[model samples]
Target: MGDIERALQTFHSMRVSAIMPPIFSMPIVAEDSPIVDVLKLLKTRHHVWVVNNKDEMRLEGLIRYMDVMNVLLPPEHTKARLGNISSLFKSILGGAEKASDVMERNVLVIEEDATVLDALKKMKRYKVQILAIVDENGRLVGEVSLRMLIDEFLRLMKLGGAQWTQHGSSSRSESH
Candidate 1:
């Protein structure tokens, strides 16, 4: 098979676990954690996963940097509903205290057993760069990122003896 074909095949056949980052590397905060803590984590990462306080393994929600920004500084075009205004003031006045108060409750996730191709498709469909990986019991495990997928694809191509060039074509193939 050609290099591209081989890469595609590998992506389709390989499970998400093959590319998922270690669970400990993921920033996780309890739902009851102060929003300040989430913000602290967001300083170095795009988002933080929120888990149930009573059961840390269970996935609860996620807080993205944009989520905090939106709550604290709503878009100018946004209509000032009473609730929306209240949330903004609360956030500014320290009333919006916990991660759950500002988290996006419906976080997109992928099963750990899913294929890399499945993860790519889900990420594309959801227009997201990362996905929280869950096990069969729906416990938070780790994460798979678009960058990881790209790196894995490049590694697969190299293993297939294909050297990609700036022109987007294989310059040469190494002999087995």
Candidate 2:
């Protein structure tokens, strides 16, 4: 079989947890943390998860780089500009103190037990690149990113004896 097909089969057989990084590696902040902290974390990470506390670490909201950028920019630069002039002024004037003030509460999440394909589908459907991995009690566990999937695919392709040219088409070795 071709390398791409073999990679697809491997993905189907794997679960998201197999490729996700542990929660300890993920950037996390308390819901009441200062917005400045969230921005600082986002400066180094793609996204940050806001939790109720550091102990329980229940997922409360999420803050992506775009999320913080949108909040800091003028209201006209974002979609909710109709009556957000006050909001813009407030954000600029330090009215937004906590992470929850600017975080997206409707975060897209996937259970750790979900298949890699399922995670991909959810990400595609929500038009997101990252997903928070949760446990049965909705506790923050780990995270998966589009980059992770791509890395896994490339690793599998190499292991399957497939070589890609500059043009992007792959070839399989006949040394078997």
lDDT tens readout by residue for model 2, 35-146: 8888888888878899999999899988887666666876555455686543453253446778887777889999999998998899999899999999999999999899
Once model 2 is optimally superposed onto the true structure by TM-score, how far is the C-alpha of residue 163 displaced, in angstroms? 2.6
Q: RMSDs, each prediction?
A: 3.4, 3.2
Please estimate how well model 1 matches the true structure, expressed as its whole-model Cα lDDT.
0.80
RMSD of 2: 3.2
Candidate 1: where is the Cα deviation over 4 Å? 74-94, 165-167, 171-176
Candidate number with greatest lDDT: 2
lDDT of each: 0.80, 0.82
Using all chains and alpha carbons, the TM-scores for the candidates as numbered come to 0.83, 0.84
Encode model 1's per-residue lDDT on 1-176: one tens digit a residue.
66777677877789999888887888999988887788899999888998986365889988777767655654453345765553443353445778887777788999998998899899999999999999887789988889999899888877777776787756458568
